[model samples]
Target: MVEIDPADNTAPPAGGKRFAPLWEPPPAPTRGRPARVNRTQIVDAAVAIADERGLDAVSMRSVARALGVGTMTLYSHVPSRDHLIDAMIDRAYADFALPDPDLPWRTALETYARGYFSLLRSHSWLLTVNTWRMPLAPHVFDADEAAFRILVDTGLTANQVVETIGIVRQAVSGFARAAAAEIADERDQGTDYEAYWSAQTDFWENTFDPARYPTMTRLWTMGAFDDAATPFDLRIGALLDTIELLIERAGGSGTAVPSFDECVRMSGPDPAGCADVDTADA
Candidate 1:
């Protein structure tokens, strides 16, 4: 696990070079004694509510009530619900144990992917939040920086690096969502994935049509699904194989970014071409 820099906890990953605090302090409550509530207290309360009751349950009034304060008072620290959610999402990201940059690229990436999936299961409400609004914060950058650094020495091009990591993230999110839904179903409806699937055994044995899903029917007959990894490690292994293929396409050249000529052809006299891009060491 990458030792997260304590200075920038609970920030979004890779927002940009210019980072800003989500909300400034409310001027220290310049009258009637000093204020007691801080941003951490408010955000923590909000996160707890969301984890237990879903994101929609986390309103300003609800958070304030959790903290034994008035709804208006929360605005002093959080500014608005959007800002509150921004903090909440970043805090959740902070729990991600960034992979060690020194590990093999595949090892580091697999470690990172597993950690992210576990974190999501712990805070499944995060899947419902519109993470597009998540802010650019240091915590966000630190985790991303570690993950990117892991692939820095790989024979993948700059474009390949971006695409590779994006694929890994999507795989983790998709798998985590599916697994989390199983737990949710069990909790909310007393039927987890296995139970729900088993409940349909009668239909599968008596009335299920094999001609419409011949492949699935065959796989089912062969017990293909029963021997699968719990979270389907097969999926991640396939993703790593795809990343390796991209690296092999690099021809074993240590070149990270595309050649200048390649960039020029892609840019074609655009003024804000390479200068605007962060193709490391290019």
Candidate 2:
């Protein structure tokens, strides 16, 4: 038997130092029952609601209804409406199928853009998906990580890579949302964009004085042509080209910008030469 020391609270009976309190761990967390709400399932239900009725239609109550659970149950998984939207955005991002790493930066970036566009199209409410200043989720960080790796390999600084990724991500989502809005507008009006443009042109011709607006008259005539380049292509292309130029100047290369000849060729193939048909801002 060990000797006990009166002054040492931890000493053993025979004089070996006591170890019970010194080595004991705090108790494990054990509440009455495990949490009933599954966070993943709650987010999934919210995404389904957004897909069916757009993001505006999504509400905590609505999601709860869809899940056949009480609103309080959802709150157990997600804190607020904003939190739900954030979760929905991440869930939508989870749908992206990442490109191969072996591809060149240009190809990889384009693949990323296309994959993102497809995701937005599938989840049209993506425009409302929050990309807060500080994103905490896995999907958000995964994209940033992929972009950082790809751009870093391209010889860009960390800040440059981050800036470039932001612009690219915005461009892809903006393009998709713009296209979705245009399509939605046309569907709501029960007429195609071309028909609406014709009506607008008739109004323009009737309201404007030709002598005072020669330039407008000239543009109107040229714009009516099926062979004319559409404004959508021009604007979006111009914006992209401007960014490409910036990147080129900043040390990047091999941008796949379309040549004028290529544009002409593409226009030559389409029935209306949709190239000439402006999307009224798509």
Candidate 3:
């Protein structure tokens, strides 16, 4: 959750900074004939290319070619290929609309986590991007802030909330990476899971001694890895259950905290309780 100053355009020193600059919208076209394209269009075209092909296919020239623009004109909208990648990541985050914060804390968290997991699955290439080089874009921060709001009301300290978020994010990323890799492997091999597993089982049974690998053989015989969805379901449930236990350990939930929707409604020119809740200690 490293924060980047939106105004800082200079790239971070190599291997020193953990994040890049937060993405900002490109400036409006000069007053004259309306410009044919904008940053959003350029980003969308780049994302489509990456989605169909892969991240390596996304370059300034490729994006411009897709958009029917010159490479230099594309550069004017997005300064570099790295900058275009930052926009693509942010756009993915923006697609996951924030869940209703009025739901119970656990419910809200489940909604958010599932949405994030699905987003990564859809854009499997995102798992290949170097996360340390990516900045906390506005949409990404919005999702994080929403989660923070929910956890803060559950009687956890600011530090605890931050720690919990770190755990949740790591879990989601790890799961997504495994899932995406399995998908890509299946596609490349042109084989379904059952076929792949059957081949592996045949080889193992033929080569390995049954007595030496009794437990492994027993599990394989019983079809332990048969269902693809069972593992995901079990793991997601365990993670959420663990968070619920942590909330209880942190002195249980507070009754006075307002729902996120309520806080927004109450936040007028003078943000009464909203500001206090945002900065309050456990």
Off by over 4 Å in 1: 1-19, 22-32, 229-235, 253-255, 258-282
**Runs in model 3 with CA error above 4 Å?**
1-27, 31-33, 203-234, 252-282
User: Model 2: runs farther than 4 Å from truth?
Assistant: 1-37, 198-282
CA-lDDT, candidates in order: 0.71, 0.63, 0.70
**Tens-digit lDDT string for candidate 1 (171-255):** 8878878877666667899876667777997997789889999999899889987776554342588778888787777865654
* Model 2 score (lDDT): 0.63
Deviation from native of the Cα of residue 109 in model 3, angstroms: 1.7
Tens digits of lDDT, candidate 3, 161-259: 778877887788788877777777789999865677677966765778879878977887888746435213415677888888877777744444555
lDDT of 2 at 216: 65
Tens-digit lDDT track of model 2 for 1-282: 222222212222232122221223124336767655577787788899789888777777777788887777765555566666666777787898677888877667777777777887888887775565433567766766666555654534446667877888887777777777777887798877677787787676577698897886787778755555332321234444554565567663433333345545667755445446433332
Best by TM-score: 1
How many times do residue backbones clash in model 3? 0
- Best-first order by TM-score: 1, 3, 2
Please count the clashing residue pairs in each candidate, in the order shown: 2, 15, 0
